[model samples]
Target: MPSPNALRRGRRLSSALALGITAIVATTPAATAGSDGRFGWPLQPRPAVLRHFDKPAQNWLPGHRGVDLAGAEGQTVLAAGDGIVVFAGTVADKPVVSIEHPGGLRTTYEPVRAEIPVGRRVGRGTRIGTLESGHPGCATACLHWGARVEGDRRRNREYLDPLGLLRLTPLRLKPVRP
Candidate 1:
């Protein structure tokens, strides 16, 4: 019969193996990048134009948290990918919608003007929101489509630039319309 120490070692090895397998299973899908195995916008909206805009209204200091898309007030906004609308309503002092994707991506549209109830599921490039009218003193109305990773909205730094995730090459900043 195996000694006590020998049996304990066997148990430890078994536990470790189980943990390793679990980790592998969890990451396999993500490691593929996405369902279609591609990261960024799944569709070419507006012909995939690569036009940049003025500096964002907010950023993560060393990094930008969201991508400021130059849009007219009330211009239709689309869901970056297929996901369920986890939140919809005026919160955080502005109208916003949060969508959770299968690949763990989430988006919060700042100052949305469109109507969409919470618990609604949205598809890639589906119109889920619209940009609100810009501030009186401000130049133009733009969409602050921010990405909060993994449905964790509490962390400000947890946000990512929607442009980066969309995989567009950075272009020259366009002047903000008045």
Candidate 2:
């Protein structure tokens, strides 16, 4: 039988572990997307091809962490916004791409072999690399992307929903003058 103090300690430790895991998962990118409030960024993944337009539920603890896109293998990966490639290499058994914008939002693309070199600034629609999400730990074959706003804690996440930033408003032609 466990003592009362021991039980209390165990509960506290479990709580801490759960919180830590939540923080990590919330911040990390996923093959599926939600909101994109992290980097003062534009709406995510350019919701043009993929048909799913469902927004994630509001957590209230933090805004959306990153954007996600379901893609085919070896599809051309494009830049989310204008920024310099800060990280483009393999980590945790998957290819990764990281970009930092002048606005202070740090964006990352995971499960991809970035074609662009680190420190090179890329504009919107610039091809960065190919999708490498089929590897182990990246089962869904999708893009996991996230962003970090300036002056925010490293672990706090506190990101904006990428969906709002990445949404594509239909373009309307101006009225023809008589």
Candidate 3:
């Protein structure tokens, strides 16, 4: 058996290792937008990120599945990547547009007035629609951007952080000193 201090040290080392692995995965080629895999901001100059992705603990649980970008009503919304318009209509009375990209990924923009019809192939940064007035829980007009990975039926569909596709700098873990 190990001493309590030793055990604690071991656990800390394990945690640090796990976090390091996560960072590595996040920065890998499969993780970000690039020549083969990646995405762009729906809003040029990248508007302020009003909200971030907050995945729920369960599939049926309530959580913010996407990011909210600060934008004025009627601001043009662009496609994050090259994809086909799979859906462009009203859902629950809110105008929504969904584009299916490569790798079975689907990006969605809500409260947008659709400018293009379904089956349209849009390139990255292509104008897809305009921001609308109502944004569910948002206090002001904002574009809600969401992405979903499509595959395997065994598990529920997973919602990914849109920021992950931005190819951002790796998160650094700082050391603690006494």
Candidate 4:
């Protein structure tokens, strides 16, 4: 019911928006897998995702900063990439293991009993710890996997979805036809 000129203008705006989004996705390092495509799943057999990542607008805001993958208690948890163990100890009474990968990316796994020690180098899929059952909100045992960009200050750290380290399907764009 609108004029032809208005319709054309709307189409142009929509196209521009799509292109802008594509550009951002294309440039993001985490859009794909790691730089060497050596990243992998932390849990063997590809555990089901109990909860997805929900990043808050601000770092201090309340949000699920990581993902919860369904797994059995005592199940081996592997390293998603080649990295050195930075911390393998308790945090707030919960067992935790953190690894520092290349490119300043750090990965954390909570409710896990650390099998490796700090400063140990781990390759992709190396056993880092065993998943524990105390993670709240999960019906069964789950692994809370998290990733962040290591920064000098805590406020400068950028949290990322640990699943992004996996080499999933590539994003393919196709032309839309009228």
lDDT for each residue of candidate 1 in 12-37, tens digit (9 for 90 to 100): 99999976664454345442234452
- The 0-to-1 C-alpha lDDT of every candidate, in the order given, reads 0.59, 0.61, 0.83, 0.86
lDDT of 4 by residue, 1-178 (tens): 9999999999999999976675455336854347557788889898889999999999899999889999999999999888899999999999999998765678899899999999999999999989999899988999999988755456567788777777677779999999
Clashing pairs in 1: none
Clashing pairs in 3: 33-38, 34-37
Off by over 4 Å in 1: 1-64, 135-138, 151-157, 169-178
**Candidate order, lDDT descending:** 4, 3, 2, 1
The prediction achieving the highest lDDT against the true structure is: 4
Error of 3 at 145 (Å): 0.4
The ten-residue window of minimal lDDT in model 4 covers 24-33
Per-candidate TM equals: 0.58, 0.55, 0.73, 0.76
> By TM-score, highest first, what's the ranking?
4, 3, 1, 2
Which window of ten consecutive residues has the lowest lDDT sum in model 3? 28-37
Worst lDDT 10-window in candidate 1 = 42-51
Q: Which scores greater on TM-score, model 1 or model 2? A: 1
